[model samples]
Target: MLYLSQFIKMLLIVVIMLQWINPAQAADLTVSLSDNQGNPLPNIVVTLTSPATIIEEAEFSPQHPAIMDQIDRQFVPHILVVPKGSYVAFPNSDSIQHHVYSFSKAKPFELKLYSGRPPQPLEFGQAGEVAMGCNIHDWMLGYVYVVDTPYYGKTNARGQLTLTVPPDDYQLILWSPLLDSKDSAVQYSVDVAADSKIDLSLKHALLPAFEGFEQSDEFDDY
Candidate 1:
């Protein structure tokens, strides 16, 4: 009887120890973004950064370079998300030539007159939004969001994004090409505990709509 009692005590101690060793499980984070009119906003980039997370730096020459193809006189995939210190290839798929350039401080360079892929892809060394435009095609606009953290995603047509992340604290940043300025960008401090879902709305209206490439005298200066 005493031996059985000792065995039962040992089992209880083991269970308690196991509970302490394994704590809570990580969770998935979902973010929903919409414009002021309560309509879903697409192509909005949602970025999360945390001090506890470690982001491996991408070398100047990345094995898989992000491709931004130029087609139908417009930048395909209008928004591109790239890791910091990575390379991006601007491939001109259309028969017409393309001259891509960006004034963004993250990485500013001019790709002068290219028919196919450039000799070397452009490198993004910093973490910020890079606005791209073709010197020849003024209406051809695109954006590249360089993120230092791994927990980042762009919202879809439904303005929703989900990321599996460790349960911790983070700083969330929401950016859109249509934003009037950086001052209007949405930023929030949030804590990710168990599976979390957050709904966000933009403060300002998006830029005026210019769906397709229209002949405008303003484009002459570009």
Candidate 2:
């Protein structure tokens, strides 16, 4: 009879320990950014940085699971953020030939014009907003916003973004190609809880927009 009682007590302790080691939930956030006029800004980048502690069950991997493509003489998702040391594939998905090139702070590589996947995809081995353009199609311009964090997302036409992030302390950053002036970007600290709702709104950058054909004009001016 004593053995049976001891067994029951041990089982209860094991069950309680299991519950304490449970994983944290992913946080929920609703982010938005715009100009003083409240106009919706496209290509807005939102970043949620976790605290130094392990809020996320998984650490950020060096291998980024993301890709950007060139189609219809345009780069899909004009802006993207990938973890550092990530391999971003730039596959050509259009009928016309494309000559991909980038001159950003991150990786600076180029691909000659080719058709049908061009053997392999261009690997972006660094982190930065590398500006991409096509020599053949001057009007073909795109921007890849390379980021090191894992929890990030871009806003849609509604100027809002929802990204699944591990619960932790984060340095929230708001980025956009457009903003009225010095107020183009802003970063703040936030404590993200699992499934918690967060929101933000900021002005767009007032800088000149990317014009694929602008390169041609620059040469002519010189």
Candidate 3:
């Protein structure tokens, strides 16, 4: 009788874990990216990748948005963050029509020059940064951060990001377009508590980013 009771109790515990517990917790995480010499990096993209063990779900995803403009022959915000597989709409808020395209490795698509809003948002279903350009202007440039993990953020001018996450040991990653190292990814181990701060400094710029080309060859694939 005792053995049977213990077995029943164990089964109940397993059932509760499968049905009641959630695998992922929603935590707020902040991140900062800088050069090898510790200068704040703007327009650098960050992403939280999954460890090899996780097979079912992604680490994170971005919300939906479709905002683009051609004011003064420039792309507003310069850089954007989006979830993999989400859609982004292009609205020509300028008097003249604009042509937009990305030759980045993740996914490349083009919107032929036309005024007003485009019919659909370009859907990117990968976790990487997609460089955007106004094919007409050699000076116009922008970036899209396609993130798969939820714990990510952009740094301010001071290179600061505060992340809220469940208190646990995690692998923290940082990336920038001009990271002194190869891919600009500086990895660290973090134990994030409530409002805990992780301050980091990086080296100097490694490569001279060409103004005209938005190619993935900019970095060595870090």
Candidate 4:
């Protein structure tokens, strides 16, 4: 009887340990955004922030530095997303010199005119949108979306984004530079469980486009 009691206690401890070690189930989230006319809206940044309890318990680390290349006097990736505290590399691929600067309160820094990669990537320690522009090119614009949570995705040409994340309640944010600069992003509360899909329709039309850029009707974040 004494040996049986000890064995049961050991089994109970192992069960408790297993429960503590296991993580919650995960799910996939797909988001689609479009204009009132049903036209796809690309370059939109979407972020999902889980509850504080889930954030503290979530096991995730920022990946390698992201790259924002300067090509043809424009930012290659007009919209860039990175986790908080992640580094971003600005490589000037064009022959002409390019000076990158941002006035954003989240991270404000300037890379003096250069033709190649900088010594080190710039670190984004805060979670907010950073609007950067080239001093030489008035039309050159880009956006850096720094998010604290790991669950985020940028919309593709089809205005669709898909990402996998642990099932939980989250705060969802959608940002687009084309939206009136005054109100560039929208936020909502969502509960994600099994594979889910969300369609977002903008309440206001996007701002006017820059005529001199590649597409006369196209606009990028400033």
Write the candidate numbers in order of decreasing TM-score: 1, 4, 2, 3
Q: Write the per-residue lDDT of candidate 3 for residues 1-222, one digit (tens) a residue.
A: 999999999999998897668654545556655555667665555544445212244322234455666566677667767666666767666666667888998878777657654556667778787887876665667777777665566777766676555555677766655555644555677655444565566655557867444332312222
Number of colliding residue pairs in each model: 0, 11, 20, 0
Q: What does the lDDT come to for candidate 3?
A: 0.63
CA lDDT, candidate 1, residue 64: 68
Q: Which 10 consecutive residues of model 2 have the lowest summed lDDT?
A: 53-62
lDDT of 1 by residue, 1-222 (tens): 999999999999998898788765678899998887889988778888888766676643545678888777777778888778788877777776778889999889888656754557778888888988988877778888888888888888899999888788888988766775752454688899889899988777788757745333334444
lDDT of each residue in 3-24, candidate 2, tens digit only: 9999999999887777677656
Q: Say which candidate scores most in TM-score.
A: 1
CA deviation > 4 Å runs, candidate 3: 1-44, 49-64, 181-183, 206-222
What value of lDDT does candidate 1 attain over all alpha carbons?
0.79
Q: Write the per-residue lDDT of candidate 4 for residues 3-117, one digit (tens) a residue.
A: 9999999999998888788766678889898875688888778888866522332222334568888877778788888777778888788766778899999999988657654
- State the weakest 10-residue window (summed lDDT) of model 4: 53-62
Q: For candidate 1, which ten residues in a row score worst on lDDT? A: 212-221
- Sort by lDDT, best first: what order? 1, 4, 2, 3
Off by over 4 Å in 4: 1-19, 53-63, 181-185, 215-222
Local distance difference test scores for all models: 0.79, 0.64, 0.63, 0.77
The TM-scores, one per candidate, come to 0.80, 0.72, 0.68, 0.79
Off by over 4 Å in 2: 1-16, 51-65, 203-222
At residue 166, candidate 1 shows an lDDT of 78
